[model samples]
Target: MPKNVLILHASPRLNGNSQTLAETFAAGAEAAGHWVSRISLAQAQISPCQACGYCRGHQHRCRLEDDMDKIYPAILGADCVALAAPLYFYDWPAQLKLAIDRLYAFGPEYSIRDKETVLLMTAADQNPQSFGGAEATYQLALVDYLRWRDRGRILVGGLNEAGAIEGHPALIDAYKLGYTI
Candidate 1:
């Protein structure tokens, strides 16, 4: 069955490893007949959540008028949401974090809660715990709190420089993940 997949590329670098991974995933997804829409926070004009309670009883609509307004509509109609980013201080980059926090506008019953969510993180450190922060947040917020279905997560480490992950096997895994999704 073909599904709508919304991919959020939260890496700051224009051609970072995480971005590459996202492209690979999109390729596989498109090849499998699924529609893929991407939002690059680095280039997108997204604003942080104001927490003014505009979304409360507002049909999951945020009051802030920014790029997220467009993203919100796509998210509401997507079957899967894929997040790809690099670990900045063990957490997502500032832009990515902001975009995610802004997603709170999606009311509990609308769309996000039932869609499948995927994560891909790249880190400079090779420690096994490099992904702890992101993994914990993903598990807690997306899985536990939002009640979204878990597709899977791909964490690639030891690649700080742009293009360092050029030939990494994780890229292949990312593509396969999308292919199977």
Candidate 2:
């Protein structure tokens, strides 16, 4: 069956390494007859969550309006969600982190649960430990807390320059992950 896959491309650079991976993944998923939607976080207008507890009282509707208003519906309708971003300070970018925090609106009543998720991360550091923080966030928040299933992850390191991951094998892995998901 065809599935709805939402990819959140959180790279600062428009044509950066991680965006390449995300586009390649989208290609493969489309080839496999799945519906794919992608959002560039750098081009989005998302605000940080205020933690005002408005959603809890307002029937899961966030009080502040921004790009998350669109993202929330996308997430609710998606069967799979993919996070593609470069590692920043050994973890996800602050923009992506803020977007994730805004998801607190979906709570005990309406929640994002049981969805399949994928991670495509790139880092300039070659050290495997560089991805530890991002991986931990993915595992704990998406998998454990939201109960989303892990589709796959492609962590590409040692990529510093723009378009560095163009000819990389991680792109192939990302494509396969999308197709197989």
Candidate 3:
């Protein structure tokens, strides 16, 4: 079945390595006949969650008025959601974190339950432990609590320079992963 995949690209840099991987994954998904859409956080005006309990009411909608309004619909419509970002200080970029926090609006409605979640992460270090933080977040928030299916993960490391991720084996792996979806 062709799936609607929503990829959230959270690299602050234009054409950053993580963003490139996201493009590659999207291309592969599209080639496989799946519909893919990408939201670049660098260009979006999303705000962090205020931790207010407004969404907990019967509305099931976020009260904060921001660019996240554009994202919520895509998130709800997607059969698969991929979060792509470079590791900054052992975690994803703050922009992505903010959007993620805002997903609290969906909790009241369980809108994201049963969705397939994929993680696309890049880091400057080659150490495997560098990805622990994002993985922990995925496991705790998406997998354990939200009950989203764990689709797959592509973690590319030791890439700092712009476009350094090109020609890397992981890029092909990412494409293949998406194709299989």
TM-score each candidate: 0.94, 0.97, 0.96
Clashing pairs in 2: none
Ranking, lDDT, top scorer first = 2, 3, 1
Full-model lDDT, candidate 2: 0.91
In order, the Cα lDDT scores of the candidates are 0.87, 0.91, 0.89
Q: Report the C-alpha displacement of residue 8, candidate 1, in angstroms.
A: 0.3
> Cα miss at 119, model 2 (Å)?
0.6
lDDT at 50, model 2: 92
* 1 versus 2: better TM-score goes to: 2
Name the regions of candidate 3 deviating beyond 4 angstroms: none
Better of 2 and 3 by lDDT: 2
Q: What is the Å distance of residue 21 in model 2 from its true position?
A: 0.6
Highest TM-score, which number?
Answer: 2
Best by lDDT: 2
Task: Give each prediction's root-mean-square deviation over alpha carbons.
Answer: 1.3, 0.9, 1.1
| TM-score result, candidate 1 | 0.94
Q: Among all windows of ten consecutive residues in candidate 1, which has the lowest summed lDDT? A: 105-114
Q: Specify the poorest-scoring 10-residue window by lDDT in model 3.
A: 105-114
